[model samples]
Target: MLTREWATLPEFAAMALPGVPETRALQKWAISGNWSRPEWRNVYWRRRSGTCGAIEYSYQLLDRPAQLAWMQRHVVISVEDEIAAFGDDKRYADEWRMFHEASQTKQKKALEILQHLDRLHRLMEAGHTLEIAIYDVCREFGLKRTTVMNWRRRVKYVCRHHWLPFLLPGNKGATGPRAACDEQAWEFYRSDYLRAERPNHSDCYRRMVAAAEKNGWVVPSAKTMQRRINELPTAVIKMAREGRDRVKDMVPAQERDRTHLHALQAVNADGHKWDVFVKWPDGTVARPMMVAWQDLYSNMFLSWRVDRSENTDAIQLALGDLVEKWGIPQRAYLDNGRAFASKRMTGGAKTRFRFKVREGDAAGVMTILGIETIFVTPYSGQSKPIERGFRDFAQGLSKHPAFAGAYTGNNPMAKPENYGSSAVPLETFLAVISDGIKEHNSRLGRNTAVCGGVKSFRQVFEESLAQVQPRKPVAQQRHLWLRAAENLTTNKKDGSFKFLGNRYFGSFLNDHLGESIVVRFDPQDLHQDMHVYSMDGRYLGDAPIIEKTGFDTTAAAAEKKRAEKLLTKATKMRLDAEKALSPAELVALMPDLDEDGEDLVESKVVQQFRPRAVVAGSSALALDCDEEQELAREREEMAEVMQLRDYL
Candidate 1:
């Protein structure tokens, strides 16, 4: 190529056109000195101008092919051989790739070197190089001398900044994945650092590093590992992005093994509408929420809440009730309902949402409790069997044969002039909820006689509880069933039905018991005296109203009470189920009472008391249960018989 400085634009082209040096070709030192940037090689070509100096010039990319070819044909210094002049440096982002269009040795070799440097720039990213780096390039695309020089330069920076092949993963301008990854070793860490993400990937990585220190495992420098990671396939880059999203969705909860339920494996929880009909303190005929927690192994409800709204406040209180009662559970399982489910409930909700869940007021409350919360798929109610049980029990209370009474706007707080003097709205709600749960759970299931063969929800729960803890005392059982202080009891004494016969133990006893003091007993700790609360939050004067009887607990008198009670219940059922049955059908009935005049669910009593052997193991295929389906099948068979008779 000719020197360009001394030549005009046209002469410069002419000089570049023929490779003969100015002295050799023109018999004179023609062009002046070289293009300035030696640091920018390849593009600049130099030849000794004279004894004084060498003049360097460049072939503009557009017109270089023909000139290069002429040089090669004339054997004016092998066009391919000249690129080696720079040794090992090929600039990373140089625009020299235009040389690929070159038809001759110099251009072809120049293009080849530029491409090779690009590959090395990518591989050196992770800070380590594999022998395959060069071999693969050669086998795939045939390496050239220029490409070799580029590889050697890369080898020099092999242990350079960050991972390897490149400088730090994404240049020095930004912080890595997060501030926590500041250390070079941590930067190099990948999911390989841990096998599981339970205490997820990040947690596992943290532990593995600490473990390495304790166990003396040879550790690779993180900066180098980061480089290797950068060299991974584009597919892996895609996976990183996608995996991050997956982790974000999975926050508040990490995937876990299904079989992890144990005594405290996980606590199943959900909300239920309470059945007790009492005017809420707000005078709304409200169905208070029943939030319950059931221990997986025991099936025993460890804690329950009966409140108006199942908001965060209610939920937090429910959790508090449990923790304060039975202690913390390892995990809590619930559905995707707004009330019970929150990402922050598990894995530190903020961590689960990948910090989308900020520390708000409600979240702060739950965070302080430290219980891991998990949510099931939305709408798949069956996923939360415990919640379903609560539902069944609560629903059963509303339809119970004996329950009667329409709440007549019972808001004690209606007189809010005095929050204290006003009936605590929650107090009435609590009474209804507490009584309803107990009655529902204790009542024999109507279908259980055949369907479960005497196995009601309460029965199953009790059985499971027994199996989980073979010898749980009644007190402990009560603790699980009722709650904090409701487990204790006091005895009835001196002609009065006592609280476990202990006088003045649980609640303040009105002067005498048999005379009629509203008796209170702790369903939780029957071993101790129960604390009593009046119709309000009052600690005063809970003397039960005495039955005004005239020396006779007579059959006729009992019959009349039964008749009245039944009439009351039937009337309510008629009103509530107004959509279904007729008023006359409802009024014509009364609770079936035995000879002794005790309330009884006649249908339930008849079916449940049946011998289990009669039903044995029932199945849809066999029609063994009066299991509703059995009755339905019989009705179908009868209808089929009638259908055939129509022809006759």
Candidate 2:
């Protein structure tokens, strides 16, 4: 390989390269660029020791003179790096920057030619003749037919896909390349269809064997088909085959354009489960839950609620928050799972949702919201902008030297700082989350992207969210988490997984009907979203939620604390209700309830307990209300409630 070293960074990139700025990495230098650009982005340099004993330097930024200066002074003592550009400074000025300039000219010319070709292709759709097509190409772009032909030649002709009208009569089985192909139709070489069969057996093999008897040639025996199947790509080969089925999002981070901020323009949401050092009733500390919604339009958190359990109630309430604030969004893009699907979340008996049928009251919400709740295609994340929002959220915290937040995660890759537990309460995580948002909005650079990236989107988002206070942490976030967890659990139609609140459903016992079984959920998906897999780890649908979310550490802590608090409060209430009243009066206070009612009065007296649900909700997102308290107390007095753990 040849090597060239440039005296200046620009000179280096100015050397031949297809995509300018395809990448910029360097050592021994750092940049403090203009405020107009995002900070802390691609601005450092390093020297490397290449295998060929070459010493080289790298540039982390492009187009910024400020960064260039940094690269100048920082020198590495010893190293080898791939030589950028290869040749001595020949001092070209010979002034035409050669390769770099030449490549640009070529690209521009190619694009111009491509545009004309595209125009011709479009005209073809309108049934334009070849001459007319050529004329239109020239007309649209000031270019001639031969010039257009050259341009067309430059672009590999797109083999007419989908039905190509008539096959030039009898032009069956391979055409064009196969047009002249006769009974020699079976001849084959390396292609996606037959890159195998003769793998190492070299196509050089002079075989007269008829190629899998062209299309009409039927194969005999399953064994033959099996042999062909065996010839297909192995795992490694299959993986290497470029997937033609999916469109690649080659748009670099910078290409994302920003749009105007409309109310229902775009919504981004993410669930973050924070392991907080919450103050237990016993004065100990543990983790809790947090789920938030952010407006991509203005970067404002539409609403955020935390719950000990992180249940469906939180998700529903979060939507309620959005409903109260902005009515409804035109689109609600959610991760593909229990959180967004309504079958598990439907509140009204009439509400029904189907990923397939997409109907009923649950569908009504979509209609009302004027929204199509799209689930990100499986495995294709960069699909949903919300997930990007969360990433930006975490990055904002980690990149900020000022933030001191902490969090843990089940999937090492999924964990964000705010999702884990540190030595403090969940408050710190909330503060960190809020501050990160505020700081990002306050930023004047590219990090303020609409879709969230170091690009044009940031600028548009900042300009739009100008009035909306998208910055700042929410006040009393922990309180909300506790409140929301109360009623999150419920049963879904399919009963695939548990709903958010930890609600129980019996369908899972489909086989175990009379037997008790355990259910689990993701604390992140409020709205009682859960995955129902068997103990053996087979996935069941996400329905029949146990309480809204799951019994993750956060929910457990919330439940435990709430249980103790409710018990304390209930004991006081029970004693007061019983005071000045006889045992019969106290018994009257209790319901005509159950037969083992006597224990209820005594238990309430000893422990001061309220039903688990009420307390749990209070611990989460503040579900405590006059009615809840009243009912919990009433149920407590007359109940021999065996000190049951679930509801009051």
Per-model CA lDDT versus the true structure = 0.45, 0.43
* lDDT for each residue of candidate 1 in 1-648, tens digit (9 for 90 to 100): 222323223344464554444334332333233334566344444444563654444433212233333323332222343334433555521212223223465454444444444344433432325454455445445666554654455335332221122321123222223323334444435555322332334454556577678765555545544544545543455446555444444435443333333455467877766544545756765556677777654455666766676754456556656666555666666665555544323323543432244332123323334556666666555566576566666455444333344321224443223222222245645655567666555556424322254544456555543445322223322222122211122234522233443334222442333332222333434444443432212333322323344544465565656855876797677778876756677766756656777665656334346554645455646655568778889999999789645633
What's the TM for model 2?
0.32
Positional deviation of residue 445's Cα in model 1 after best superposition, in angstroms: 9.7
Q: Give lDDT: candidate 1, residue 454.
A: 53
Instruction: Name the best candidate (by TM-score).
Output: 2
Displacement of residue 356 (Cα, Å) in model 2 is: 9.0
For each candidate, give its TM-score against the true structure: 0.26, 0.32
Worst 10 residues of 1 by lDDT: 160-169
Candidate 2 local lDDT, residue 602: 39
The weakest ten consecutive residues by lDDT in model 2 span 162-171
